[model samples]
Target: MWQWRIVGNGGYTKIQNVASGTFLDLFTGTSMPGIQVQGWARSASESQDWFLRRVSRSDVEIREILARDTHNAANFQGFRQDLLYLVLPKSVRDAIYVKSGLKNMKDRGQLFDSDDYAFFLKVEVAKWGVNTLLADDFGILWGVMFGQKGNHGLAYNFYLNENLDNIMFFDPYTGDEKVDMEYKAYLAVY
Candidate 1:
């Protein structure tokens, strides 16, 4: 799975779904002041739509000018050819696999385990320049969920610690916390 961060001018209020090419309105189209924006699908506008801005082989940023979907709501989900344009830094990728505890014996390695729900998250204390420990932790949590293993509730709790409070919240639908508490839990078990 790939994710993107979109930035635009003015106050666009939606994150465009690259696959469907439809814009998803963020904040229910209220456009509150000082709120972060995100990406969504909107049938009638491109004001907040964006194109890719390559930062490196593993890092590309999205540029646009809308307020919608600019914040937590703009995060891209699943795999999509169009959305792949947002490249992640090689270091970030490496950190993901490492933190997930997936042995990278060879230069080429698999990103996830068989269940596809769990991953080894690498936390490089030295690589804190461009990456944050919290960010890597969230990546591991999300990767597991995307792979369909960790409970949604657990993932949400970990996400909140990673600063994802804007998108999800505590709810009855939350799943087992034991699996989603943190990647450290898995390490302790092993």
Candidate 2:
């Protein structure tokens, strides 16, 4: 039976078994993977904390949910509107799109397919530098790479408070080895 649901993001999570009010715990609080696991009371112990190693294309459904529902509205409430304010004119949008590599694109889905998708967003974000203050907005942008290891899915970082340290742990696609380290470092520099 499907009885477990993950609470919290890929960074630090607690898998709760709905059938019982217990969380999935690492047996004896072992730090390595493939260790024995069991259900235990919610004690906020280190054993109960888990990190999602990857997000793949097959997890698009999960990604979409996190994107749409988990994002902190306070951080992004006016971001799109503000972006529009700067690039709403047809000419401006077209130019920014072309610079951001959105020209000839039929849908947003293609955005997920591009290797330079973040760079595209960066172009757009760069355009607003003079008009908008986006220091806090960078976190959400960094999250865009959340599941990129699985090969560019529709998921863009909607989960909040994501950072380099936590994101590096997620493989997202294979849930195996960590990927996109260079890109993450690049963004950190950007």
Candidate 3:
């Protein structure tokens, strides 16, 4: 599914995929350790190139796939612990983070799902401040849209753990068993 080919002139190489013709791109803007290294539209960005390093007199090191049989590589396509969910596509996710829901129009001036993503996050946050039930209080009603071509695309839902200290959300994009909340962008998943 992947091909490591030689490209450029001065000892440069490019890693491309066979199924989708996209190249391995190391995100354009940021350089954080977990910055997304994804498959983006092939272009002349340095993120699309790789450098071969010589370790010893005879050892040349390149990429490595530690766990290859867990279906992780096939789904995510690459490795970046901080950006593990990038298999979902940053163009579809976001810039600073690969987040879902509506932050496009409200807080974060992002363009990924600007209108819809902002709406979804707004709904989730609003739910916390809203406590109006017909039998209890008063509030306005609202709704969300979900589909491939809707204002809000529903890939997953958010929930809290039993203790409520940390969030336990579900992301169809990330099939993770355990997620560290300290550094990663996505909340912990079941």
Candidate number achieving the greatest TM-score relative to the actual structure: 2
Question: Against the correct fold, how does model 2 do in TM-score?
Answer: 0.30
Q: RMSD (Cα, Å) of candidate 1?
A: 18.0
- Alpha-carbon error at 146 in model 3, in Å? 70
**Global lDDT of model 1:** 0.30
Mark the 10 consecutive residues where model 1 has the least summed lDDT: 58-67
Whole-model lDDT per candidate: 0.30, 0.42, 0.35
Instruction: Give the lDDT ranking, best first.
Output: 2, 3, 1
TM-score for candidate 3: 0.26
Model 3 residue runs over 4 Å out of place are: 54-190
Which tens-of-lDDT digit does each residue in 105-163 have in candidate 3? 34333444323442454354335324322222222111111222223323233222333
lDDT of 2 by residue, 60-144 (tens): 3333333343222223221221211111222433344455444444344554543345445555645654355544322122233
Better of 2 and 3 by lDDT: 2
Which pairs clash in the backbone of model 2?
53-171, 54-171, 54-172, 55-172, 55-173, 150-173
How well does model 2 score by local distance difference test? 0.42
